[model samples]
Target: MEVNRFESINEGTILLIDKPYGWTSFDVVGKLRSLIKKYTGDKSTKIGHAGTLDPLATGLLVICTGKATKRVVDLTADSKEYIAKIKLGETTPSFDLETKIDATYPFDHVNRELVETVLKTFTGSQMQEPPAFSAKYVNGKRAYEYARKGVDPKLEPVPIEIQSIELVGFDLPSLVIKILCSKGTYIRALARDIGKALNTGAHLVELRRTRSGVFSIEQALSIAEVEKKLSNMCNQS
Candidate 1:
């Protein structure tokens, strides 16, 4: 059989990777594609990510190779969990640190009680406007294309469900939250909405996907680890 079967990749294999900050999802996929081709000499190997992770965020990213690429849809449909750090009293155009702060607000009136109350309202089904600087496609082009050019394009809201949100840390001006949400939910947008509901502007500073479907960060491999595995595969092949 041409299949190496290492990691049971004969037909397909799902790799849970702890994606590092600054590495885009495509970057990981590209790196793996090159590695697999180098190790197994299978130039036809197909690879793809279940979902796209922003370049700034870090966490468990589901990567599929070979025939597993066919399961991208179902893998992406899985619920996800994230640990997000949000900055109150500020707003960014990108909703995260990807862009400069566009505005600021007084968070002095915002308190813990208000935070908890507002977060409760966010749980359940609601319509969410994705950040203009997101990967959303508009008229066959990316929404960020308009956003980066200061062109305001009409982006419609999408239905998203937030199963639960927990306030992990609550020091003024900075909030840490753990969120369990359905697919397509953007935590950066959640930070934006939370800031609005709290009567203060807010933006995301950091985000990490702790869990996705049945996969957890605890079971994920780092880039170095992935490289090691590929090296072993190369030697075995």
Candidate 2:
């Protein structure tokens, strides 16, 4: 590929990158900004991304460069799909594997059939309360900040819709499930709520965003691959 052709790549173009584990959305944007500057040597082109994925989770991260930053508002509202593993018999303060396990219960009472039946309850529109260890604002401060301390704040319930929930697999206390939901849906909350419904406790053990609207993992470029592409451009010049 010729370096000059990128000049025609234009602004407002969308790029999908498979975000690596343990990297924040801001981290991705920073690396991308550096890569873009290294290749184009043009600092005026803007770069941005739609939506935020927790560092523990990995998958399609939609990136917009140049004029595409203007469309982030609309893109952030697009539906997202994820394949996640929920670990039963344990409850975490953050509602995911990232937090400390506050309690654990016997899971002999939960089976595949029971898990399937519980899925029925999560489907459809419902009001869900965000986790205490979340980015959601609380009294003008981030909820996670208050949660990290000893204070448990009053987190309000927000509307969310589960378009579909499928039981992919189950291995005793661990369950693999796929979810398609509207914006603002929290899988962490779902895991906790499902645990509550089953007389057990649950937390997200693993998570991967398989799809985000038209963007899919299939269309995503790895950070290394993207860096390579930029490098090739510099060498050619």
Candidate 3:
């Protein structure tokens, strides 16, 4: 039985990784694939990430190798939770700090009470448009391309649900929030709409994925740590 288990070790492996901000999902997969190949000397150990993470956002990234790659879709469809900060009184093209600032205005009139009311309104199912600078495809091209050419694509609004959104902190234009949402929810659009409702305009200031489906950031391992474990295992042999 021990020998059988050892023989099946390469069949599948699920690795949870704490993805650093500014690294694309593909970048993580590529890095891990290289690491796995080097460590196990298995050139065909297929590696893939379960979901995409924006460059500005960081947190749990689920990586599956070998037969585990088949389970990525189920993992991605699971609900996700995020800790995010939305800045009032500013609007950006990308809906986050990465894009060009479109407008800015006074937000001193905004208050906690008003924010709570707006949060309540964001609940339930509603149509949400993804950011133009997102990976969403449009006419065989990325939405960002249309945006870059100053041509606004007639993007269709998709349905999404906000299970819960609560304000955790507020400091003038900066407001920290916790969101539990269904799959395909765009926090950037939520911030934009929240700003609109508050009459101050808003953009995402910071964002982090704390949980996704059954996986949490707490269980995520760093690339360095994974490599260290691999090194130790080889040394033992």
* Index of the highest-lDDT prediction: 1
Kindly list the per-residue Cα lDDT of model 3 for residues 26-70, writing each as its tens digit: 888888777767767778887777777888899888777778779
What's the best-to-worst order under TM-score?
1, 2, 3
Write down the RMSD of candidate 2 (Cα, Å): 2.8
lDDT of 2 by residue, 1-237 (tens): 111124432354777889999999889989988878778786777878888898889998988877777878888898999999999999999999778899998889898898899899898999999999889998899999999996897899999999999999889788999999998988899999999999998999899999988778887888998888778877887
Write down the TM-score for model 1: 0.95
Stretches off by above 4 angstroms in model 3 are 1-9
lDDT value for candidate 3?
A: 0.82
State each model's C-alpha RMSD to the native: 2.7, 2.8, 3.2
Model 1 poorest 10 in a row by lDDT: 1-10
The true-versus-predicted C-alpha distance at residue 9 of model 1, in Å, is 2.9
| Deviation from native of the Cα of residue 140 in model 2, angstroms | 2.0
- If the candidates were sorted by their lDDT against the true structure, best first, what order would they fall in? 1, 2, 3
Alpha carbon lDDT at 163, candidate 2: 95
Q: For each candidate, what TM-score against the reference?
A: 0.95, 0.94, 0.94
